[model samples]
Target: MKRTDIRKSVHDFVSLRLDDHQAFADDQSLQALGFDTQDIEDLMFRLEDEFDLTAFTEEEDRLLKEAVTVNDLSRFLQKIARH
Candidate 1:
């Protein structure tokens, strides 16, 4: 999928998984949506499988350390896709 599509999917999936409407691109702090660290890890795994990429070390770091927004996750995936 294109980057935009992936972005939308990430946002939609995050919203649905977290059961919140506040997971739009602008919503930072996914944890506020009830996504715990485990949930975030699961989401990253799902995204990895969906995108068909072998995750790098930075992927997890980025997800855990700095990916506060859906757009952050989208950009991370786009970065992985590019590589």
Candidate 2:
């Protein structure tokens, strides 16, 4: 999937999950958006189901841990799609 599409998906999911209307900025951290560990886990599972792909391969888990913003998740998804 394209990066832009991945980003839009992430933004939409987060906004819907949080019931927030504000646009997501690339630099906005998930922590700043109020996503706790459980929320992040839920989102990871949700994304995995939606994309029919696992998000927790050892390397991907490390990548996920480093992801702090919507853009980061989008980039991760883009990379995953390649493999």
Candidate 3:
């Protein structure tokens, strides 16, 4: 999928989960919007289902831990979708 599509999907999922309709900035941190670790995990599962992704690799999980912003998750999804 295209990068913009991936980004919009990420934003929609997050907004739905948080019930927040504000526009998200690329550098905006999810934590600032009240995302906890559990929320992140849930989001990951949703993304996997939406993108028809297989199980994540160890390296990819590690990269996920480093992801703090919408842009980061969007990029991560884009990278995995290409694999």
Which candidate leads the pack in lDDT? 3
In every candidate, how many clashes are there?
Answer: 0, 0, 0
lDDT of 2: 0.73
Per-candidate TM-scores read 0.80, 0.81, 0.86
Alpha-carbon runs more than 4 Å astray in model 3? none
- All models, RMSD in angstroms: 2.1, 1.8, 1.5
Runs with alpha carbons beyond 4 Å of true place in candidate 1:
20-23
Residue-by-residue lDDT tens digits, candidate 1, 1-83: 59778877787778778544552444576766777778888888888788886668876776678867667778777778887
Please give the ranking of all candidate structures by TM-score, highest first, separated by commas.
3, 2, 1
Best by TM-score: 3
- Model 2 CA deviation exceeding 4 Å by range: none
- Cα miss at 37, model 1 (Å)? 1.3
Query: What is the Å distance of residue 36 in model 3 from its true position?
Result: 0.8
Candidate 2 lDDT, tens digit per residue, 4-77?
A: 66777788788887755776687898888888767876776676677776654784667657878767777777
Question: Which residue pairs collide, candidate 1?
Answer: none
